[model samples]
Target chain A: MGIPYFPGCTLHVKAKGLDDSTRATLAALGLELTELPEWTCCGTAFPLAQDNYMGMVASARILAKAAKEGDGRLVTVCSFCYNVLKRVNFALKNNDEARTKLNAYLEENYNGELRVLHPLELLRDDLGFDSLKTRVDRKLKGMKVACYYGCMLSRPAKEMEFGEPENPALMEEFVKAVGAEPVDFPYKTKCCGSYQVLNNYDLVAGRVKDILKAARVRDSEVIITSCPLCQFNLDWLQDRFADEDKSFSKIPVLYFTQLLGIALEISVAKLGLDNHYVDPKPLLQAG
Target chain B: MTSEEMTRKVKELSGQNPYLCMQCGLCSASCTGIGVMDLLPRQVMRFLQLGKEEILKNRSIWMCTTCLICTARCPRGIDIARVMEALRTINLRKGNDILAPEDVPAELLAEIPQMALTSGFRKLSA
Candidate 1:
């Protein structure tokens, strides 16, 4: 009846739309997302330094608690959190030294027994796409959607283990199940300039520019993504500098959950479609 | 750290061996940040192999988003992204913060997601 969910920091702050839509859509699917009690940030970006055992503590704390909770599995929507948590889980499971050091530091014994699931994996593995197609009342019949994986969903392929790191089909498969057409673009697995958005705004915008154009070229009305950062860069940067480029038209980028809410007949208001910088409401309504 | 120590430190920090690279240039080709990088990913590996520390000053290491595209494409099974992180860790641990939190404009920080700020500081700050 319930699944322990980790929304991470972004979902609580600026990316409420992703959180709201995820909760709303999952509720519609007959699953309750119970936020784990006393969950803190997953320490975004898995610390790469072997000596940075301190960096692993935050996520380790979360996983240790999730292990004792209702279901032994923990799910998070933030791409960074998913990658970090999953990588930490993988690291803790494989390396005895890391597990011993981290567990000693955290004062808990967690041998990476935690199962972290992204909603996409849940839909494919648990919900079953065939059943999802049958449950849809407001099927998104004619809309062409381009799903952007944008790095975190599947990368360092051995660790994340969700989909193909290159040319991932999970998001596209979800689109097809909802009766919408999924358009494949080259930049689907590409990085959206990530943390560099802070240091070089233009460089980050330039990357987003390419991503938007690639999706638009494929004739996708909107691009959907799982990462909040990816959604922010791809969606907001276009509106931030729209006037600067007269030749390029603005396109909407949205969280995949928002589209899921739509396909499942969750109200547009509840889906947080209006919160986006490049509004997909007009396109969704028209379609 | 000296040029000799840089290679050893990177191996110690990243747990990835740069010496295994065959100069395929696949990492550079696979990098999404190659557009802005002064030193290509392949060149970073080459510099490490040559025991050259000039890679520390290159803007490419900072520009790298650490998406791991190159790590996946490496024929030698090198975690090139970890190598990039190690290069950054060297500078950051020395208190050479590339992105100062104080310099970020108030408007953008107010608008940017908390994860962005957290990850930015984690990687860019000491």
Candidate 2:
């Protein structure tokens, strides 16, 4: 599958492992990821919620650049980027007033049809999951992981839907392909309270607590997720939440691709597992 | 608010069945961060139903994490998260100062660059 890779804001920084492991895994499957040089943020949840025009302009700006780079399809690691970019692009295509306004705002008339794809979508639709199954060097066995989709991947247009929205099988399939047992957890597509971290720490803390509590009760060794915000809320905030509630545990929250890379026997150091707030070693070793 | 207008508005906001809400408190009960909220998830829906634009514009909407727990727990299959997004849209447009102008608040901004340098989330939005 051919597409320019947009790791967005989070994967390059906090969830760098996701980008690294994804690139490696895709390479194993014979796919190339060309990151957009000087790509901007998707303008995240705020632009769309506040101003559709701004959201369209922000996404189109990125697409216009990608168009200039001569890549029509963009692959994103973050669910937020995938959702926002795709929705904005969809708006640009369907709404002439939107297109005109956004084009005017961007100072470039973008007629380019750019398809925003999630990395998992490319893996499943373009590369084929069966091929991924063949590349598994180490199968994660008996390790129950909660496949957290958060908000970005499956919502709006189901931009990267390889499975059900309420009950997803895409991430689960990948987990199983790597040999780990995907647990039936309640909070898979649930929000990590991604955008709320800025205003409501207490609420974010509660959401994290619930996610971890669900994982713990389900006997999950680790939690696997796709979005950077989800990773942040679920992983880094665990300690603070635990301190707040005493009962919360630092359940190693991992970027989903890291687990796949490890199971694929890809180098862990390069995967950036060390960067996570909750160390995944205990869970990885235990499994 | 007219019933038709309310229905259209809710559909525009959440893309779910507003009428589906059984008014069962499961959503509010299961809300992880309901205590910090001025109007709970269920209340958000009720306000939408009643066309309480002011309540929809309140700072509480911005406080929501868009955690679908409330929506998931809703007996009527009402998507409270989408409603939260709708309310967030309204709050943001009305310039309700929930957090700082930046998605990351000012107090957190000092640590953001350092955290970004080490953690990587800062670069995500940059």
Candidate 3:
């Protein structure tokens, strides 16, 4: 399958591992990712705020790029970028007023009509679980892990409308395909308060505690998430939450791809599993 | 002069669905962080419906965490989260802030070097 790849800013900066692992996984699955030339930030959590029009225009700009880049779906590894671009497309494609405004902006400044897709959506909906299951060689058995959906993946499910936002099991099913136990927890769709980390560390840490605690109770060896922000807050903030409440529990937060990379017998280092704040050595070794 | 006029702007932006919010307090009741909030989710929706731009601008909007419990439980499906996001967007437009104070959260930021070296989770920032 050919798809225009849009790696949001974080994937290149903070969550490079996600990009690397996703690339490897797609390649293993026989999917070709064609990079969009000179793609810009999707305006992210910023545009929709500062200027809905500008933010959307920014999103439309990327769409125009993909549409012109020939024939291929625009696939993204970053949830934020995916939502931003997809939401804009939804609005522009459905609302004439929005379409007029966006088209004008595109014609004058931009050039593509690329449809956006989250990597998982592509695999689950396009590739089918049966094919994915057959491709799995290393089964991650006995690995007790929780799936954290965070905010963007399924929220405002109507607006984002990827799947069942309330309680999505696709990622869990994928993890299960790899042979790991996907722990079910309450805070799956809860917020990690990624944007609030600075002004209120205490609050964010408290929220982090709640998420990790739920996973811990389930005996999840490490929490797995698709969002970079959620993974950062859950895995990185374990210590602070613990400090805030010395009785705070600690659990490594793992990326879905890292685990996939491992199951495929890929080098752990190449997967960036060792880059986590919490040492998952115990958990991975235990698995 | 009237409370209705105060929320006129919110009413316009949200398309007046919030006007039907019966004050059932279901939003506040279903909110995950109701007790922790200064105005609660219901109150925020009410304020937005009435066009209380300043209240919508409150950092509390950003506090929502985007959990859809309020929407999930609302009888009308008012989408309280969207109201909060709109406010957050407006606040951001005015340059009130960027990267939410906890962009990376302290504990998480501290783990950057370690997570980078150990997690096999590629660090794009170098």
Candidate 4:
């Protein structure tokens, strides 16, 4: 049986590599991700205002549709989708007034039973880290990867409830299972200026500079993240920051799934590993 | 809006009692966007408590990424991010959008993830 999956907009477009790698990684672990036949965007931002039911519509619809389809769980790849979907589910489950308004607006009886999950959480809970190690055909023995959690997967602990929300070890443990060294950095859970990147480029570049410096000083070879926004900011902005200052070192940012795909003996080309801005191929070969 | 009206409106929208803040400054100290915000998270909380309408005009409201670092670290358990969102809501509901879709560059539109565009629209628009 295939598990229902919701691939948000970015996964099908700019973050296709993450989507592809996630599918391959899960498949290698003996689970197939079945995409929802009719899924929409999770509105990206979970309306922070208590009354913004319009913002909750998209995510509530997703939760309702998934539950009505006879599945209590729906998994998505990107951290943005996971955050919105998860928070919306939490909000609807807790707030009776908002749930009623949203249900009436969408004209769907969403009981808020559907659970939202990211692939990392799924892998950890479903297949133990040791089980993951057993499936690794190729071990990343000499590689040192920095697991960048960023702000999405680690924020609003009362709402997101993902990982430690501070010193998340899920990605770190996953790195160990893949036979790689996990470098710890304080900036791992820091915000990368997120949506501000589209407007405040210099501000985001400054953030990227700090994150890269912290990780590099710790001797991390490659930085891995589950969010495409973080991957893009670190990967694309690092190149720009490096060009402006010769002393600035560039680091390749890879999706966690891409790293998992490598350990699963999936081809880099098939994972679209070459599509990164910093060119992760050299480090893969080095490891 | 009257001072009391503003206070009530924010309380209604955010569902957070701004007065719970002890002015410990942990929220401001831990804020990720402190470098860009005109008023720190703690200051925003204080302003919210005072029902100061001027807080709505500040850049601090726009700069908040809703990262919730402040919320996670607040000693008083005050959800500062929600307060910031309430201030943003007050401003945005006035039809004065912080970010217009046309203002976004084509280069960014082409390269950035759609999530960026969607979040920007959701947060910065009315």
Clash counts for the predictions, in order: 0, 6, 37, 0
What are the runs in model 3 whose C-alpha is more than 4 Å off? A46-51, A108-114, A244-247, B1-5, B32-35, B46-59, B67-69, B85-126
Better of 1 and 4 by lDDT: 1
State which candidate has the highest DockQ. Answer: 1
- After superposing candidate 2, which stretches have Cα over 4 Å from the reference? A46-51, A68-71, A107-112, A157-162, A241-249, A284-287, B1-33, B45-59, B67-95, B101-126
Model 3: per-residue Cα lDDT over A1-287, one tens digit each: 36789887677767878888888877777777877899887766523221356557777878877777756478887766776787877776776767777788667433234557777777787777777777766457788879888767776677777667778777887778777888877788877755455445666677777787788889888788877777777777666566767776688777787777877777766677666778776765654
lDDT of 2 by residue, A157-246 (tens): 233343555667788887887778888887777666665565566767777777788889988888888776778778877767767777
**Chain A accuracy of model 1 expressed as TM-score:** 0.97
> Which candidate has the highest lDDT of all?
1
Model 2 chain A worst lDDT window (10 residues): A46-55
On TM-score, the candidate that comes out on top is 1
Question: Between prediction 3 and prediction 4, which has the larger lDDT?
Answer: 4
| Predicted candidate 1 versus true structure: per-residue lDDT over B1-126, tens digit per residue | 798898899999999988999999999987878888888899999999999988888888888888889988899999998998898999998888788889798988888989999998898888
Write model 4 residue lDDT over B26-116, tens digit each, in one string.
8888776778778888887788777788877898788777888888887787778888898889888898668888888887788888898
List pairs with backbone clashes in candidate 1: none
- Please give, as one word, the docking class of candidate 1: high
**Candidate number that wins on DockQ, 2 or 4:** 4
DockQ of prediction 1? 0.84
Superposed on the true chain A, the predicted chain A of model 4 yields a TM-score of 0.97
- Cα deviation at A113, candidate 4, in Å, is 1.4
